[model samples]
Target: MLTLRSFEQRDWPSVWSILEPAFRAGETYAFPPQISEAEAHEAWVEVPAATFVACAPGGAVLGTYFLKPNQPGLGSHVCNCGYVVAPEAQGKGVAYAMCEHSQREAVGRGFRAMQFNLVVSTNERAVRLWKKLGFTVVGTLPRAFRHARLGFVDAFVMYKELIA
Candidate 1:
């Protein structure tokens, strides 16, 4: 069974194992492809309200996620998050579970909705998964993300209203 746990010092290495390739790929997230470990940690771990690890009974981390405000002031009612699953764990539903959990967690934390600001259109797996999870691509920014392999690609602004 998979379980979600608050980030701990021991979780850093495993978290990095998942994040590094994603960051290096520069495909999904906006982080610089060459971002260093400390820099990546500052951006991924230090800034979010909370970080979590998806762990197995043996304590192996399969994925990680972070939750934060989608924007400031008037936009604070919406939450934003990012997920990274271990390469070995891909296609096994780790991201889906994290997205579901994050929505519940966001609502519990008083967020009225959730927004994904820059979901790469080329990332069909994530786009499909988020849609299946009830989020809508309310808007799209053409050629917004420069996917490492795809050059410039469109990105979507996905949103889900959690309250009313």
Candidate 2:
């Protein structure tokens, strides 16, 4: 079993382990593959309104995500999030739980909806999963993502309403 909780300073090591490989992959996220630890920490923890970690009952970290408003001022009603699961924990439903949890949490935090600014086209698994979770591909940005292995690829802007 796994549980979610607010990230703590002590959680850094565990969260960092999960974040490194995913960020280095340069597939799903736009961040550079060789991002430094301080930069990663600042973006993942310092910038987001809330950062969460998924942990096993015995305290092993399984995954992490950061939730924040998609924009400022008039656009702040929409929330945005990013997730990264530990490599060994892939295919085990960690991300599914995180998405479900984020939707509920977003509503509770007063967000009217959630949006994913860039879902890389080649990351078909994520696109499918977001659709399964009720998100829609509202727009496609052509050759928007510079995937490390696939060169330039299209990306989708996915969105889901949490209220109304």
lDDT at residue 9 of model 2 (Cα atoms): 88
- Model 2 segments more than 4 A misplaced: none
In the predicted model 2, the residue pairs found to clash are none
Candidate 2 local distance difference test against the native: 0.94
| Best model number under TM-score | 2
Q: Using lDDT, give the best candidate's number.
A: 2
> Model 1 off-target regions past 4 Å?
none
Candidate 2 per-residue lDDT over residues 12-108, each given as its tens digit = 9999999898888888899988999999999999999999999988999999999999999999999999999898988899999999999988999
What is each predicted model's overall lDDT from 0 to 1?
Answer: 0.92, 0.94
Cα lDDT for residue 154, candidate 1? 97
